[model samples]
Target: MMRRVRAKKFLGQHFLEDLGIARRITESLSIPPSHVVEVGPGMGVLTQFLVQREDLDLYLVEIDSESVEYLHQHYPQLSNRIIEGDFLKFDFNKIFPDKFSIIGNFPYNISSQIFFKVFDNRNHVDKVVGMVQREVGRRIASGPGSKEYGILSVLLQSYYTIEYLMTVDEHVFSPPPKVKSGVIRLVRNEVDKLPCDERLFVKVVKAAFQHRRKTMRNSLKYVEFDHGAIMHLPVFDLRPEQMSVEAFQELTKLIEEHPLCE
Candidate 1:
């Protein structure tokens, strides 16, 4: 018989006990047969359903040694697929030579960091389905002109289409988290290349939202730009929250064309 595995506080382990939600999350992945990496599969609640899909080449990345050992004993068939390491630091290029989808009941503490890594590897990652802190999920899937819209909204929206899937109550987990949870899906768009400087686009979006209340003209003062020229541009008058992903791309182009002197 399998012994009960304790949740590790430092690791942010809140194992999902609800099978219905687990099945729903597993079915959220729309990608065809390919590599699939599940992060922090604590106690293998969702893993059980994921492994059922023979089309997917399932792999689990768990940081907790105890949980990893438990998975090894329970799912002996996944001996080579179960990777024991930090998902943030693990090199995906080494594991998958091509694209893959990421799914999990992600750790609430490092949820944002996981998305950042996903964004960084956007080229090799086509789809992502995961559960995160409610606010974080809403923030990522939020569009322009909303209070939740910010850096992540713009950055992620640029390359991927985000969908706020479902809300999960705190009662679903073994040790209920203080806040509610949400599931989100991110599907990569077909933009082969960005119209403007991609790096500068990120910088501009972050700078503008640094003070979300301020208009683009005032918020982007720290960034190198010709204030006089850009002041007349319509985008400069609007707040960061008012601009869409396309608008931000346009703003970056304008700044690059007419740069300010130090």
Candidate 2:
């Protein structure tokens, strides 16, 4: 048996130990025979299971130099595919050069940031399956009326069908996390439309949620727009979270058409 050292804390490393969990995570991904990308592949527990499947052209991205080298030496078949770099900093489109599936046991420290990164590459990544804090998993899959619904709920729902699969106990990891974690899958829909500048959409969503209690008329003040044009919007009295995704698209479309000319 490989003597795995304590998972690196600095990297938010919680190495998954349960083979059942590993198999279940991979099984959740129905990747085509062509390609898949796995991020934060610590100690190659999941990597071992993933590569054995003949269908996927599996690739691994690991940030820890020690683990990267260890994986390269132990999993000789993956030597060419193992990328040594921060997953947050790497450009997925440049590597895969085609649509792909993404899976990971993301570091808890930057798990939310990781979602934004995946959102950016939603076009290139057909689906995302990963483990994250249970709260975050709930927020992503949350609906309009739920308290967990916010910027992430709005932004992610605009592009993909987000679903919380199942929760894993803290004892499942090498070094148990303080909180339980859950796996989620984001499947892209062809019908999903950006409707406006996606970057701007996120900016607007964040601004509104930051003052979620305020009505759109009040929240609109935070975002740059022609007050005159915004007055023409159908429901200026509604709060940001109260509005649906379609309303956001319409508002952003109108706002962009009338940027505040300095």
Candidate 3:
């Protein structure tokens, strides 16, 4: 008899017990699926369905040793594919030399961090379909002018087109989470790279949102300058939340070209 794996709270493991929902999540993958990496796959709920598809070159990343052992024991065919490590640290370039997509019931705690990993390897990660805390999904899919539009929204939006897929109720999991979950998809867009310095772009976005309440003039004080040179620019009057991804890009270019106060 197979022993059931207990959900570890510290790992944010909310095992999706509903098979119907699991099947739906699996089907949500972008059509003509190529290589797919499943993150934090608990009890092979998603793995079971993913393996049924003959075309997908599937890989599983599980940090928990217990789950890894269970998956190995149950799914013998995936002998060398299951990676026993953290998805954040795992090198996508090593395993997938070309392109791949990501799919999972992401641990709510580390979902944001996972998105950051995707951003860093945007060139290789062509698409992503995953379940996350509802609020987090909303923020990721949100465009400018809304409260949910912030750092993650701006950063990822620059490179990918995000879609909020569905809202899932809390009752579907083994140990139900306090909050509902939502599914989202991100497809890599035509913009291969932003015209400005990528590192500077990230720094600018983070700085502005860190002081979101203040208008750009006050928030951008984090960015060193004479303070008077660019103050007359119309963007300086707007708050971080008001600026779009393009606006931030323009600001980054402006800062890059302008002289900084020593």
Best by lDDT: 1
User: Model 1 TM-score?
Assistant: 0.97
> Residues 1-262, candidate 3, lDDT per residue (tens digit)?
4798888999999999889988988888855748999999979999999999977899999998889989998898996999999999999878988989999999988999999999999999889999999999999999889988899999999999999989999999878999999999999999987989889899889888998888888887867655667778899999988898898999988888776766
After superposition, the stretches of candidate 3 with alpha carbons farther than 4 Å from their true spots are: none
Task: List, residue by residue over 18-41, the lDDT tens digit for candidate 2.
Answer: 999999998888767867888899
lDDT of 1 by residue, 1-262 (tens): 6787899878888989999999999999967899999999989998999888988999999999999999999889999999999999999989899999999999988999999999889899899999999999999999987999989888888889999999999999989999999999999999867899999998999899998999998888888878777678777789999998999999899899888776
How far residue 172's Cα lies from its native spot in candidate 1, in Å, is: 0.8
lDDT accuracy of residue 6 in candidate 2: 55
- For all candidates, the clash counts are 0, 0, 0
After TM-score superposition, what is the CA distance of residue 98 in candidate 2 from its true location, in Å?
Answer: 1.3
Worst 10 residues of 1 by lDDT: 225-234
C-alpha lDDT score of every prediction, in listed order: 0.92, 0.84, 0.90
Candidate 2 Cα misplacement greater than 4 A, ranges: 232-234
Q: Where is the poorest 10-residue window by lDDT in model 3?
A: 222-231
